[model samples]
Target chain A: MNINRNNYEAYFISYIENELNNTQRKAVEDFVAMNPDLKNELELFGATKLEADEKIIFADKESLLQKNSTKIIAWKWNINVWASAAILLLLLGVGWWMMNQSAVKSHQFSEEKINVKSDSVKSSELRIRNSELIKTEKHYLAKNNFAKTKRVENKNFNAKIILPETIDTAELPNSWTSRKKWNEEHEIHVVQEIKPEEILQVQKNVAEIDTIKAVAQNAISVPPTKKTEEKMIAQIPFKTSKNERQILKMLAWASSKVLGKETNNGNFDVSIGFAEISHKQALQDN
Target chain B: MTINDYNFCVTAYADHLFRFIFKHTQHEENARDVVQNAFEILWKKRDEVEMEKAKSFLFSVAYKNKIDQFRKQSKVNLVDEFSAQTKIINEHKSGLKDALEKALNTLPDIQKSCVLLRDYEGYDYKEIGEILNLNESQVKVYIFRARQSLKNYLVSIETVL
Candidate 1:
């Protein structure tokens, strides 16, 4: 644009602002030189440019600086401490797993196969059908020629456990609901039939044994504290077949013990099909 | 930016930053507070900000802080005071430098910012716009108006002298 009087103010402002190129700057300079009257206006424009004062320093420059933060980032733990903590955590984890497994195994008690074998001597079978353990299921030997059968009455059971002499593994119920159902339905009756047969004559066959203890009638005492009494069953010498051995194994898995160490002196006069034997019964010497 | 780069900024730009803020606030303490706060924020965000952009980042933060302070105190117009100072200066016939300084003080807040950023920092129009959050045209207009006001003040003083 031409530097005329009307538009000189805009050119002058641009000139002082350093916004004009060399050509525009030289034009404005020449325009002022030609008309000495405009020189005063150019001088006013020049005075408008403010210079930065370097003397005005921020006194505390050190305050604005940041440290490298090396001190706060330091970790005091050694390698041994870290390794010890890791090992402790691992041990705690394994212990918790083992305890959980044991608890899970106990719930599946009824799922184990029942022990069934024929006895040569005339004996009766007892079934405490309630899935829940009976606080008291009396097994007392008669002083005379008698067989006593005590039935623990349980009603409102819907599931029955499948019981037989021999069972197919494939046909066995797999689900816990079905197993729990079987246990609930087949719930009742304890029949102990001990004929004038000796205890030695009876086969050591477990139908659904959790325990077997010899209790004499005259020797009735306080209720046994132990839910499981392994020492109660008389150690009668009886030969076991493959099926019987399997039954013993299932009994061992159930009771955590298969054979009894203790023996009673009195001979039984009746046949017996007993389960959950509590050896806490009184021992009578014949 | 590294701590060294940040420290460098502190040593290099702190004085200019203080000067820029001090001119606007006119309160040395408030200006110092704004500068300190701006540096703290810059240090905190140093990882995100590039080394080249650190200067602009600091000025932007300080500018926003100054605006917040202005809003808290309301628009502090010194027109009456400026006129009184101008009257006193005319009577005394102050030096050109002193007269120009007083003329700069009498400008509008935005005009002062535009002119200070342009002349003090030697920033081009676009850079001024980025720092002050204004368009290039707005910055140019502000600068033009500021220069005109300063020159007019100077001319009147020159006439008196």
Candidate 2:
């Protein structure tokens, strides 16, 4: 209660910091409560102390705050970006599933078909004709029971027959309907021409006709025309079983369908005949 | 806390927090920066920050930011120089503003900060300790030292005049 400026420094410092024990604090509080002059001195000291603790404001503060603010903003931006990425992934998954469903539906609706070209059908037809020719030659020789005669031709002989350059394209009645029909049924491949032995035997038959003419049995008789000879040769039987004939017709129909065209055209004549390859063997073996 | 709560905290505490930072760093711009950053951090963590602890939390952030700034500068002499200029101003008072300003600057950075929180912001020693990352005893010592320093400067003025 009777405190003076001389001792105030030590006591004031301890008092403000609450360093005083309970009794000391109580004494100071009671003294201030009773004495206005003492209280006023304390208040002045407190005000002056506050004034003395002033701070100077410097210019660098703004830049520091700006740097700190920038850091805080960057952290916020990262959070937003992560959220956006998660949303994007979810959308992509949905879109992918939708596309897969449509693709599967389209695949189910489609059909697979193979188209055979027209050229292949034509080639198969040619093959059938050749096989028929070989079969006819075999049958003819077997039916006659002819001796397997070999006519040895003299290559040096001047009597070699010359074939005609061209044949007339005459429309013949379809005498070979069954042959044509048989050919239409099968997938055909052309066989090679008859052997030299067959050609020699034909030449021998011609020589015999010449000899008979020289003996004067028929003075007016003429050499057979190439067309007539070809017709006679084609008359040889190419016997096919009923089942074989049916299969050949089906193959021909299939081939025609592949070409997208009809096989039997009245304008087109098939006159090429079958030639035996081994007449001597056929005649002897039969 | 919502946006409104965040704004309220900022409006209530920004200037006081800036003053504390300014007292320590002696730079108004750096003080503003430290306070703003502290508020921004609070805003970002609004949900986690409690209203009762908001003041201390903000001061704690600002205090740490100031320390980091000083450390980055990498020269103890700079801090000492700042302290010396502050001491000189406190001793020589040309005007009331000059005297008060210098008096505030005279305290060491930690003491200055403690005094600001105590007198200007009206925070207790426990709150000061939490903000400055000091123990309660350390906070008490800082505030005590700061007040003593200010009293001596004011007494010197009275004696000289």
Q: Can you write out model 1's per-residue Cα lDDT over B58-139, one digit (the tens) per residue?
A: 8888997665565344245432333221111223435898888789878888889888888898889998899889999999
RMSD, one per candidate, in order: 16.6, 25.5
- lDDT at position B21, candidate 1: 79
Candidate 2 per-residue lDDT, tens place, A29-65, comes to 7766766666654553565445323344332333323
Candidate 2: regions farther than 4 A off: A1-10, A17-26, A29-45, A51-286, B68-97
TM-score of chain B of each: 0.84, 0.78
Give all TM-scores, in the order shown: 0.55, 0.42
Q: Model 1, range A1-286, lDDT digits (tens) per residue?
A: 6889888889999988777999999999888888889899888888999988675557677888887765544433445677789899999888656544443442233223222221101111222233332312232211111212223345211111112212222232333333233223322121111221222222233223333221111112233222212111221222344433332232222221221321142222111111212221212110
C-alpha RMSD over true interface residues, each candidate: 6.6, 7.3
- Worst lDDT 10-window in candidate 2 chain A: A118-127
Q: Name the best candidate (by TM-score).
A: 1
